[model samples]
Target chain A: MPFQPGCRRLMLQIDILLSALANGLMTGAVYALIALGLTLVYGVLHVINFAHGATLTAAMFAVWAAHDGLGIDPYVAILILTPLFFALGYALQRFVIGPASHGSDSNILLVTLGLSIVIENALLAAFRSDTRSIDVPYGFSVIELGNLFLPLPKVIAFFASFLVAALLWGLMAHTDIGKAIRAVSREKTGAALSGIPVEHVYAVTFGLGAACLAVAACLLMPTFLVNPRVGNAFVLVAFTIVVLGGMGSVPGALIGGLIIGVVESLSGLYFGESLGQIGIFLIFILVLLVRPAGLFGARA
Target chain B: MTGSARLPILIAVIVLALLPLGATSNTLLNFMTFALIVALAAQGWNLLGGYGGQFSFGHAAFFGTGAYAMGLLQVRFGLNPWAAMPVAMLLGAAVGWAIGFLAFRARLRGAYFALVTLAFAEVFRILANAWAFTGAAAGLLVPLKLQAANMQFEDKRLFYWLVLAFVAGALVLTAELARSRFGARLVALRENEDAARALGVDTLRVKLAAITLSAGVTAAAGGLYAQKSLYLDAAIAYGPWISVDALLAPIVGGLGTVFGPLIGALALLGLGELSKMALGNLFGGAVPGIDLIVFGILLILAVAFAPRGLLGLFDRLIRRPRPAEGGEATP
Candidate 1:
């Protein structure tokens, strides 16, 4: 009550900025989760996985089906869907992508592109391309701090991203499968010579990547809607994050995700929503041209 | 048939040219015109992606650039379509050169190159959608002028014939390029960039030239599209679908062949029709997804079973597999 009116106005602007930043970080956390899958697939496969967005969309639909068709809670659906998608991802790589590509980099690119087309249309055909969202009890509930309101599900997603990242880090750093995956990523021929089951490791990595999508979809479905093409909105941003973080660096993705989220949020605040997309793409081009190795990636 | 690219292209062109005499349906004419437009765009892709070995996933940048030019010049400046088409093509080539300069200078290749091009296309799309001069989201429409001078014909078959002429010229140019010294240099870089550089080829220059030419041809296709459709929108001009269609025809028909995009475009459209007929019922009739689903499957199958495409398959069926050491490695 005793505050100067001008100072109060400045304080309110700061609060709005802070709120946008918080919202961005939340969206970015999910983006990181999405990018983690992309980066992991790239590490071993050595090709950009075009099917990633469709896979996320597929997983989101799976989550939606669990909620609407089977009457399972979205959060609980995550536990069931993650492993199921891991298997789907594994089989897709082993049976479809790997065999079809025959180890050519260009061929793999086409195959993945084709996979995206198939997966997106399959979802379209199955779901009829309508956008749907779950009606969670707390969907409109928010945590209020001063004038700022943070949605409950988004806050949960922000924290869940860290937990997922930590778990993924532990797996990559400590587990034998992780080691094999890394070894294969570093050098397929060398890994093969060193008694690693190269093909199996590739499949496992793909499975892990898909598992990440399932987790992300489950987390996102609460705050985000599902449609045949919903993942596309996130995919470009994820690609930007993956590139910014270094192509294969998990930590880079996490940090990059947050940075991009903030940038996107601030830009959207200033430039309006649609035109704000230019900011992310400009950042992407700058990073790619100026420091393509990204902040964390090993120099190619 | 065996040695001359000209012979096959000529025969194909003659057959296409004669189609108007036998078929009088407007739907067929419209369909043929659209297929030719796609084939032109695919030929553009074939130059850089197939022959030069640079796979650009965002060719829409060039296509949309050209389309926008054609749209703005004709609609805003009231220029003739013939004049606008070349200007649109030059603009597209300029965009290609600028992108190539930055991307190649940075030594980006493979997936990096693909993604960057995609980003550029999206950027152009965003700008186009926002700018009032480009008609913004309401889209730019070419006035319905039915005069031959406007490049729009009262008779739909005339438009079909005109497009066939353009496609025929593109095919001949592509065939000529395939046998040229510059073409050999492109193939050299494609096969082994480091080795080509080591052998004194200016790899950067070759890539830039290929991309510029590629974009120009693709832009011409875009110009042709604008004239035919008589309307342009952000989605139709700069969307990823054109980029995909541009590349798909070449990859499916034959990657490095002069005739690939034309053949691929026809076959692909044919396949779409076949799938619509066969699988439309499987998914409940009239769903749009069935044709694309078939396309995706066909793309995978093409890469797996016939990497060189239909022409290559024909080559294999007619002749013995070349003994590795002494045979020419030409596509």
Candidate 2:
């Protein structure tokens, strides 16, 4: 039975509960997008991409530049920035990280770490550590569901995540390049022997990952503010999601992100915001300690 | 340990000791003081990463623990700073042992171990930032009492000599480890854990011991930092910046060697000051991050071009190849 909003105080808890879940879902969608990119790269490269946060920061800056300088809407800027970021990611992996690493795991790790340091410091130098956001017309708009109101930008991001994930799934399932990517990630030597230009496939995978980050950055700019350090917070959460989702599993990432999001939202409701961040790390540590394979364990 | 092999370390320490007598510029003293502190921290890292081949990504966990212990014991409980320093190292060992036990028991190695350690450091940072016992976000500051007993000195050179003493001690310890039976087992495990285990090495015990000692050594550096700076914050103590520094020094100097951290710290931080000066001149003011950008480039270049670090490069330049001794300083 539906209770009247103005009539009863008992319904307030229920309202808060529902609201937290709704916010969790909305936030989870963005996390899913971020983790998807990380998972894809981890799947193919077999090395953690230490520069993932810096790359996201760069994409956020691009969106901010397009809006603040050129007057393009954040959503409209996504179309231009996604492909641009794709090319940038492709070039970075194809030229810098590839040759520098020389196919060694430890070398790759160091090179990526170095790359992150460079990118982050460069952003700090250029941006002066200022928080940036797009002042959209619809930034304040909200949709009312019963007694709960959800912000419209979050609502848009939630659905956009579904669309992107579906499109990515279709691409992986049906496209020739996608087949090559899967083959390469599964067996590099075999894929190369089977005439799949392995290096090209690696570059393509990196590009797609960066494209995902661009879409995520665009969706985020309307509601969230950007600074050089902001992406670092998300990077840790995204890593937790990847771990929970079983490293390289796409569906696992989406579901794991939603679970973590709900957990984070509820913990924030209970604990103070700063301390609540610890909940994510606790869950991550527990997952690593208790079940290294993860609950999903689909493709671990 | 052979006296001839330890000849270089002796000369280096003596040179460092005499440096203040010859040229006591405050800038140079400040740089050397900070560099030696980093070298101590890097020595802690090299014990596990370079010797045991663990490659941790969250050494800040140990460093911060040490710093916080020094702060809380002094500020809250009114413990003497001298006593608090050792306590910090003890706590660091306990923390390291706990993490090592859980991780090694689970058989997590390589990247997984690194990730877990990183997560642990984040947990500590968040707790320290928010918890009241550690003074919350305002951070803890040591009492500004100028006395040798309190480990504070007005002259600054006394503190420099004190840090060099600690660094010298760490160098001797590392040099001793190169010839010790424990170091042999550690290097054996690094080469191949399965082979070492088959050859009767207690792999788990050795790793745990290495991590515990590593944490203690690193914590000592943290304690010294708190004493020298007279302040400690969650970010300052527990940040990823320190963790990177702890790793970078040994790699740039010469991995698994006694003097790697000291040489690496001086070279790296020296380059850092050079960049800062250049950028300051160019921009006409203090500008952040130009040096770090240079550091990042150097890290990549070092990995790609000189895997054995500056010491190895020097060795090549001099064309002096030492005999293959036990526990050669190479991965």
Candidate 3:
């Protein structure tokens, strides 16, 4: 209990723990953003879009291409890419995805998986296997809090994540399109009977889902390298978070992502880096076993 | 459909079985041998994914378990591959039974089930890698032999023959299974689970049987692969690519069909090889991503256009010559 060398070590440990937790939270925000799109589409359409991560990858690539090939900043790329992504999602849902959704849930699963493979390989061919990253003007800058060190870009990314998630929540909760989307998410038949164009709602829902990636890709751009197969890791983690947060529960996804992120970071810091993945998976299994409905998900 | 249509298929199998006898090229023999093993693995997967309606993305765990079993036994105990192979099958079955119990007991279906299986395989890979006895990521290598029963061969023809025998055995067993009463229950469960359960079907038992048998077959293939390559490593034995191949073969060939797995393996393996040839060094030098790109595009086109797979398209072409029978062949 008295101040000693051991106590000093303990203090250092605490400092390390806090910093890891902060790092985890920032990464978790990005996870939630990516997962929110997947959960939304799944909640409405009852189909897990395996291609969701590929969409994120595509967005990252688009940003990289714009910045590197066409001389556009990442922030500017977001504005330009957002509309393109929305249109891409809208057209995809209406044409390719809509036809595949024939009341059988497996159809979409198969289609999306196929689409993911396509996107990954297409990007691989176009970009090669080399890793690419955006040169953020202030990428190396970090802020310190006592013994805790925080990277500025990560902090910015986290704040941007919060902003986007909040805007999405507001749009879903307060707007007319949001109401229709929510209704469609709950019950397509009922929503259709109520004179809402369910098809249009599906398109908009898909667009909104794709739009979530715009924010996530931008945030991820600073800290991580983007490659064709980069989506592989994100896809698995996003699914785990979605499952943890409760499938189709927006709030659950946000919270679930944060929990996983913190847990993963702490596990990496305390245990080993390899062990972190195991902890995340254990959490996944535990959540599935204890609460199939997820941490914040409403029971169907 | 009657069993009469199987005659042509039987003949096709017979021709494939004899293919290595006259083949002089070692490369051709190796390619054929690889294709046969892959085809066998795909058929093993077809039992669960196509017939049992349980899509597993972690069959590689069983394959790896079997491979490691053989490798470790031979390396540690100096046992013959002939002895080690049955042990591998048994070990593979046990692993299958354990994972199947954990997963199926929970009634995790669809994509959720698939992800759980993927997790299981990853766990297996991690554990295998950490354990020094299994040689970790560098992989486990079996001592080479020049005998038949030991499963070592100086001639590619002999390896081809062994692969052919195993593949044929798998196909016949799968066909026999389809005719079995349990297989009927499995089909019923696959078509309509609730209805099958209502009709006194023990869905769990049916699924377990399918899983165990599938795992055993996959393990046997793994054992053969260990002997053929004279090496077994985590990456090759328990790789994610194995799962991808397993899933892709059944889906791209024809789900629940007898010849589907074989056809899928041939087409995809050919495509894979072709992609590597075209994109392996296509740029100033060979680029790494072109094959994946080609593969992805092909898959998207396949899923979008021919979800039922190549067999479905073949059936359409064949049936077109005859009068339209209400277009029942259309997926």
Predicted structure with the largest TM-score when compared to the true one: 1
Candidate 3 chain B: worst-modelled 10 consecutive residues by lDDT: B322-331
Against the true two-chain complex, what DockQ does each candidate achieve? 0.64, 0.59, 0.50
TM-score of chain A of 3: 0.95
User: Which of 1 and 2 is the better model by TM-score?
Assistant: 1
DockQ-based class of model 2: medium
Model 1 CA deviation exceeding 4 Å by range = A1-3, B1-3, B281-284, B320-331
Cα lDDT of model 1 by residue, B9-114, tens digit: 8898999999988998888888889999999999999999999989999999999999999999988998999899889999999999999999999999998999
TM-score (all chains, Cα) for each model: 0.97, 0.95, 0.93
Across A1-300, the per-residue lDDT of candidate 1 in tens digits comes to 566998989998999999999999999998999999999988887788888998999999999889899999888988999999999999999999899987888888889899999989988887887889998898889999778899999999999988999999899889999899989988999999999999999888899999999999999988888889887778899999999999988889999999999999999999999877999999999999988999999887
Give the distance in Å from residue B285's predicted Cα in candidate 2 to where it truly belongs: 2.0
Q: List candidate 2 segments past 4 Å from native.
A: A1-7, A298-300, B1-4, B320-331
Q: Between prediction 1 and prediction 2, which has the larger lDDT?
A: 1
Residue pairs clashing in model 1 are none
Q: Give the Å shift of residue B212 in candidate 3.
A: 1.3
- For candidate 2, the TM-score of chain A alone versus the native chain A is 0.96
| TM-score for chain B of all predictions | 0.94, 0.94, 0.93
Candidate 3 at B137: error in angstroms? 2.5
Candidate-wise lDDT, in order: 0.90, 0.88, 0.81
